[model samples]
Target: MISARNFLHFSRGVALAAAVCFFAATLAVAQTDALPSWNDTAPKQAIISFVEKVTKPDSADFVPEAERIAVFDNDGTLWVEHPIYTQLAFALDRVKSLAPQHPEWKETQPFKAVLEGDMKALAASGEKGLVELIMTTHAGMTTSDFQKIVIDWLASARDPKFKRPYTELVYQPMIELLAYLRANGFKTFIVSGGGVELMRPWAEKVYGIPPEQVVGSSIKTEFRMEDDTPTLFRLPEVNFIDDKAGKPVGINQQIGRRPIAAFGNSDGDLQMLQWTTMAGGPARLGVLIHHTDAAREYAYDRDTEFGRLDKALDAAAITGWTVVDMKADWKQVFKD
Candidate 1:
């Protein structure tokens, strides 16, 4: 019923509105800081500067999208690894859960230590006992079954100090950093000493990192046919421990290419950082998250049983790696 002139004017008005909305959205995105949780500190500036240099096509240090790889350690770097490692907590809980099936655990050295909540005894069990505990709790199931177990445990597991689910303890700044890197054409990968299967179940949901992008310690998995269906069964055998020196080996085997950026918290990530940043390259970034805030998060370094940061702390200073002081550099630790 409208005249052609009127209809044309109405269409133009709508187009103008759409254009204004689009411009506003673009402006908002451009103005938003990628890492809002991170304070405007030296570490944040360093991260942004490195990413910009590598991503800008006109920059001399520009790295192609295909070569833009960033690796992050999973424990204290991405999430909370305080009081104890998340995996260790899982193992301890698993020991208690399976204790009813194995009565001998009541008298077993490490198992008994775990059952009685004897911290001193558990520590005395050493790496060997820890390995034994991990094998027993993490193996003797199919890969799919193990994944379900991990998923289930993570769903209900709560940090003793924070009383929050373990997954909720992930660092907000790190999460933002991961997304920022990905947004800038970098493929982010989790290279951790935690069990690969254990992390694979929740990595995508929590960190937006896929299962294949995770490189971590793993137990032996054997292929077999179960009732006509092919299955990969986990075995109680140590395959690879992706910590310290093993990190580079795992990266080569899994990702096949070197990462230009690496992030970590503890000494376990020293070799990984060295491999990523020290490799002859255009512009590489290495960041160490120093847990310096005891109020918001647990702070521990050289003296801590888990996530010992001594060697890495010293190396960061010498190697020019940017160390992020959690208390000063991060405005918020965990996402609300």
Candidate 2:
């Protein structure tokens, strides 16, 4: 009962309306699916369940927005820490770059090992030798200078396996989890064993956690004025070590309030989980990221020297902490 022209226009309008409706539905699904990168497994469900209980008004586990503090370890928990800690890699590169300035490094046990790329010899250097490497490469510069050096190094630095910029190596699932928690009125902080200065420059851009919310191990610094500019000069001395027992102390000193949730991957984070979950004022959550994905990423637990997941892996059974099996729990490791 319509002209050909009228009928054609009407058909076009119908298609347009359908497209709009479809687009809206797709958007809604995306908005609701907070962790698309995560497999719809128990670990994903546990995270969602905890967030719901803590944020829901009628739930007994509901915590006020201010008290909903969540802490995360940076290295293995949030991003890749396999092969070696990213910071150590940076230090090794730095030792090489600075070799021309210090000729004695050619003969030094650790430095010589680093230059020769001898993993066994480097391991033999032990904790003292490792500390010496950290001090030699990390100190004797202003905080601003140190940050700039880190930023420059990160700009070109690529993971040995992925061959992608280190920043691009962050776990997509964890990034989604961070945004999900923040969207739910929970504050997030990165409590890492990595240097505070090293992370503060990039954490906000990389993880959405601002520099002020980053807490980590640090060296002693001296305030001095150079050419009328006030600067904090990093010294070759340890001020704090924010690992194991030190994590809780760092959190207490910096964050003040006890975190309601803690996420970590290694034994270094055991005390942090204990502090968050054991002090029973409210319902708390502890999560450990188990590196089980060998195909998509490196897999190491009991045997690895770096980012070893041993005691905490054992504790998760008794403490009831959610152990996220990376192979089974995460659908995607890195973002597209």
- Estimate TM-scores for all models: 0.93, 0.91
List clashing residue pairs in candidate 2. Answer: none
Per-model C-alpha RMSD: 2.7, 6.1
Residue 218 in candidate 1 has what lDDT?
94
Sequence-dependent TM-score of model 1: 0.93
lDDT of 1 at 276: 91
Off by over 4 Å in 2: 1-31
- Global lDDT scores for all candidate models: 0.93, 0.94
Question: How high is the lDDT of residue 209 in model 1?
Answer: 98
Q: On a 0 to 100 scale, what is the lDDT of residue 100 in model 1? A: 95
What does candidate 2's lDDT look like per residue over 6-115, in tens digits?
99999999999999999999998677898989999999989999999999999999999999999999999888897889999999999999999989988988999999
Residue-pair clashes per candidate? 0, 0
